[model samples]
Target chain A: MLVIGELINGMYQNVGKAIKTKDKSIIQKLAKDQTKAGASMLDVNTGPASAQPKDAIKWLVETIQEVVDTPLALDSTKADVIEEGLKLVKGKAMINSTSADDDKLNTLIPMAKKYNAQLIGLAMDKKGIPRDRNQRSELALKIVSACMEQGFPLEDLYIDPVVLPVNVAQAQGVEVLESIREFKLLSDPSPKTVVGLSNVSQGTKNRSLINRTFLIMAVGYGLTGAIVDPLDKELMDGLITAELLLNKNIYCDSYLDAYKKK
Target chain B: MAVDLLKEKWQNKVGTITIGATKAEGGTRASTVTVGGQSTLPFMFGEGDMPNKPVIAMEIFDIIPEEWPATLKEPFKDVMNDPAKWAKKCVDEHKAELICIKLQGTHFDFGNRSDADAAAAVNAVLEAVSVPLIILGTGDEEKDNKVLAKVSEVSKGQKCLIGDATDKNYKTLAASCLADGHSIIAESPIDINIAKQVNILISDMGLPQERIAINPTIGALGYGMEYAYSIMERARLAALNGDKMLSMPFVCFVGQEAWRAKEAKGPQSEHEDWGPESTRGPLWEFMTATCMLQAGGDILIMRHPKAVEETRKYIANLMK
Candidate 1:
């Protein structure tokens, strides 16, 4: 349960507002609460939300580190913003993105390796987010190869299979699942598979409900990590329960303790 | 010795781990204890050096526990009411080399004690015992951070293990340990990939591999302990085979898990042919601990004094 807390990103309207106003309080609170809630790394994304994206990212990273010791997952589409975030991050942070796109790879992988940061490479190339299992697997391999070429350890690269909304591509969920399974078999030493868990349940009523269901399913398919909202007790609970039942967590003891606290 | 084939074949080194920080290293403990750095399997000195022997830490609670079985209750009696006394008994009577104090009361679902309360309990135990200490947070991420942050700050300069850095909350916990100069136990649900991932995540925070301990989460006998054992054995193999990121020494929480099984706690009347509660209880813990030890566990956290005593004798015999 490597919970990369998703609460600090711009995609959320409240966080976006917080970013625009230079409201350190809101960002600080999010960092504290998420760390308290068990986020290993707080994902900081100020994409298109701040007047000065680079500066805001830097401030968020610095402020969060000041209050808590948790690592930051510096997230942004712009390489420059990520570079700025990396500069401010005290320890090696994770880059939220790179893709099979040659340009994105050429720009981000070198930057990631240079900063000693782990990378989350999206399984999307110039073709954009794949709609089929074959394309998804192919893109993952391409991204992994690009990372290896840049001398990044396979362990340092986390491959996200670009989870799409189930409503639009209902069967694509199965494809994504198959792709994750296939990706694990591609190499003896393969990059870990992470999913933007919320993406699978996008545009659904009771989004947390769907997100959690999909998350459990993803974990079943060898999904090793996730970028999700740690505050979603239901989803977190589901993940904890799944880990226990799968015998991944010995003794099935932590669930009671985990649930009561949540 | 047939030219000592085992020595010739086994060349992997599991790094050594020393519990407690000495005064020269900046801690108040009377002395430090070391384990691991084995070049071969347990007690195979004919092959390679077992530089440091395995050590045991007795598990006690910050608050009096209500959910424990009556058999467990019979051992500590009133002392369980006081963590310091309980911890002292573990060190003095049980001969535990370390004490693992679990702050179960701070859980949001438990008494929900404040961070200050948990810190006071931790400090009290540290003051009472000369042995190295391991402080565990209530499993609630939010509460864990609040309490563990306080523990880390309060216990600064003492190289105690502040657990359990999970994938979700490792960064904050790892960072806290890094700043405070303490060791951490990085716990991953029983998967090699996750174990590797967490090690990487903690290391990314600039914490050295020596300062981190990995817990792959153990299972008791008849409760998937075999799976956990295999995972741990494989992890140790990977490390010895040279996976730098997965090479840290490992710890196992044998007490918390072994005592939870039905064989250990279920009514004796229900399984008359099985045996008395006293016999079955310690046996369960012993079997679980033994399984993990063979799988390369560097540290074991135990509960029953009898089990701990039995395990010590077992280790002594194996070493000889």
Candidate 2:
């Protein structure tokens, strides 16, 4: 699984305060923590708490880069902020993300090309996250089609099925998984599938348990990447064991340690 | 009419490691055998490169194997008493590509031979064969650590594939193999994860991944062979998909595992409908081995001469 650590976002109190006060230690520590916890890339988002997302995004990128050299995922609703983070990324960056809407696609696709970065396309539109599998597939195909039309490689695209909180939308969990499987069948060189893995358990008790169960099911349905809290050892262990049983990883007695080392 | 055929281009190739260093390279072997480096599934001719054809290494024990069925023991009856002559017969008479010297006598439960005895037996076989050698321990962790290290010491710089290092007792054997410039076999009990972890551990000890092979533990044709087959298939697929830790070539104990099955070695009088044990035993061995080869086995340790010949001929034709 391509783990994009979801901790560096500016929504959490420490991150929000860190962005405001320019306290590099808090952000840098999270960066080092996530990287050490098996995150291939760290998602940098100036979440709703940020008053100036563009500046915060750039600062987060620069601050994290100062410590570790892991790849960054620039997350924002505004293309300009994402573009700001992209400019400062020392290595490859991921745009997290674009919706199926034409405006987001037109802006982010060009920015993605300009930055030479992978893209995360949400299975959503101006109307909002789809309620059913067909609508999810429709939005997914739109994102895939836009990527193709823009000459962006589908292999570089990660189509996210926009997971919702399972407590309220339990029926949609099945829809999201089915959408993930269908997303792979969208093109010859398929757009990789990702999920905002934490979204499934938002505002729920046993959040980690719910997220772990859903993530394993999603992987079975061809989910390739995930936006997750890498520091969550239990969740990470579940994924490691799942991938091992799926034969995605070779087994060893110390596989838990081996997975972390790799 | 022109036809378009489908093909896959894999990102990783199985690692190739040569056994038996020549005199110039530090060993006295006449020739070396290199296996692995396949870029596609076995027999997928037009798809990718099979850089080296899979080779067969016939197993010769330091001490005569008493429990081997009469069918298996028949060919080696004359030479089994001497490891050197037995190894020579396997090479000269049977056209074996490599000789796998099993130090069966060193096992604590077996003869419990001394380390010096084990070293002498290994030296005797090394002196007798021009072909490459695969030096296997007796499969007891404690005895293997002591004896394999000794065998490795005596055969230093010979580039033998020293083997069966598990997750528990790998450090000793891995360190020994690394010191002597020989390759190591990372053994897992038919589990792909353990197979990869053993490789990682060996590599972690500074022995390069290129100098390792995975033994996922073979099962006979009727005896959980599908489990072994699937494990091999999955390991090969992961290797081709660019999983670096899994890209090492695989070794399956075809002769030992196949002969253990009653269908292959049991007397024909016990079950009349199963046909004569003469052709039945060798055929059982051949079928199991060929299936394993198709699943991307790089080096097969086999026993029966007829099975070895048939498998070699089949490999020659398929590789062509």
Q: Pick the candidate with the highest lDDT.
A: 2
Which docking category, incorrect, acceptable, medium or high, applies to candidate 1?
incorrect
**Residue-by-residue lDDT tens digits, candidate 2, B211-241:** 9988989898998889999998998888788
Docking quality tier of candidate 2?
acceptable
Q: Which fraction of the native contacts appears in each prediction?
A: 0.00, 0.54
Lowest summed lDDT across 10 adjacent residues in model 2 chain B is found at B5-14
What's the lDDT for residue B205 in model 2?
96
Instruction: Please write out the lDDT profile of model 1 over residues B1-320, one tens digit for every residue.
Output: 46835343453677666778878989989888777787766566776777777888999998888888888878898799899999998888888899999999999777899999998999999989988999999778988988899999999988898899987898778888988888899998888777877777787689887888989998999998999988887777656654556667889999999999989987688888888988889889999998888888889999988899989888887777
Per-model tally of clashing residue pairs? 9, 6
- DockQ score for model 1: 0.02
- With candidate 1 superimposed using the best TM-score fit, by how many Å does residue B265's alpha carbon deviate from the native? 0.9
